[model samples]
Target: MTVTEQTFWVVIPAAGVGSRMQADCPKQYLELQGKTVLEQTLAHFTHHPRIHGIVVAIAEDDDVWPTLKVNTDKPLYTVNGGAERCHSVLNALNFLKDKTRDSDWVLVHDAARPCLRREDLDKLMITMAQHPQGGILAVPVRDTLKRVDVACIIEDTVDRERLCHALTPQMFHIGMLREALEKAIDEGVLVTDEASAMEHAGYSPLVVEGHGDNIKITRPEDLALADFYLASISDEAASDYDGLMADDG
Candidate 1:
């Protein structure tokens, strides 16, 4: 793969079984539209000029491998993820460390979030360049906020306007993230996200505003919405390409 000088590497942790999706296949490998959810994700990075290569982190005995339809010519490397999300990411980082220098950029994206928008991703890249630390894509919370007690009742209405929902393609300088992961492992810190880990280390990650349609495919109903988004995207791309071809002809 022609990894551009400024190219960023991606680590997709596909180790989770995704029991919430209630599908026989692991959620990442499940077909959406004409492509697998994981494939749709790869399409984003593989086609991007700034993305150099990809390292997919999967389980050791993963059953989803045989069914995937990979199109990128870059070699796919596999590593067994730990029981937790941070562990899986650290394992992927260790694998990537052998291939890249410490200063390179690494992006950790969720495998289930196939409905990710291209524009949002490009925004993240631009944000990272201007950012002092690093950045991730996220959408501001538009709805009213609430802090519920253990009884499932609302304790108070928090300011929702200040809250933002974290999404993926979370980017960081390679060495910085690796150091954070190492500290997390030694200190037994089970961080919820990469941003949290960075925060733990006293670094603030810039949040690039994302769209509502950049949905994470979590529940079953999300799959239906994913279908609609995919069809619309395909139609738009086809029309755009046809116009370009017409002008060329």
Candidate 2:
């Protein structure tokens, strides 16, 4: 299917306080390349032709959101989020119920992940065309794993062959995701992401291999890493544009 043939929506759960980052504001509201992290994250979808709308779940007392100067032509909605990431996503899904069709695809992304490459997003969309159950962008574990005890002692070495680090932009049908999340919540199941919720509902989500640079900003050091990735992306785009202009000349 072509990009124009399908409508895509995005839900960003930006309610987390990001205690690990130790920032004065939420990590999503932190400054990155002159714009807030949330603004940069929103840019990935806002400019995409295939994306129809976006919903962001923020804290009930989130005063920072109103201060951000986010500019986007696409319709953007904000809802009050819950305490946890799953709750925030579920609330966003609930808000989209009245605005979107049940069959429409929804891509749940991390607000702190600002370095998501456009190619990864394209790859995910292409892969999802063949995946009715939906999928997420992930990278295989390359390092040796370890199972540790509470005492900081290594218990056992885990096999890395079957393991993959899950990333955001987890795609699923709006209705299916909503139902899965709701059921998980009602059953007292812990769902860290959309794929986990789907898995709990007995649905196997596909994993589309993506770049490791698509990292979520969790720690203070992660901000520097994100800045580096964003700079690299900008440089790549500039080089591509210069090449095109030179070819034209």
Best by lDDT: 2
Candidate lDDT (C-alpha), each:
0.77, 0.88
lDDT string for model 2 (1-249, tens) is 544477789999999999999989889989999999999898888867668999999999999998877677899999999979899999998988888888889999999999998778877876785578898999999999999999989999999997999998999989999999999999999899999999999999999999999999999999999999998875332233233222223
Among all candidates shown, the one with the greatest TM-score:
2
Q: Alpha carbon lDDT of residue 151, candidate 2?
A: 100
TM-score between candidate 2 and the true structure: 0.93
Write one digit per residue (lDDT tens) for candidate 1, span 1-249.
Answer: 112235578888888888899988778878887788888777776655567788787887987676776766665677888787888888888888878887788889998887677666666765585455787888888888889999999999988866899989899988889888778778988897899888888898898888777777888888889888776664322133233222223
Question: Global lDDT for candidate 2?
Answer: 0.88
RMSD of each: 4.5, 4.0
Model 1 — TM-score against the truth?
0.88
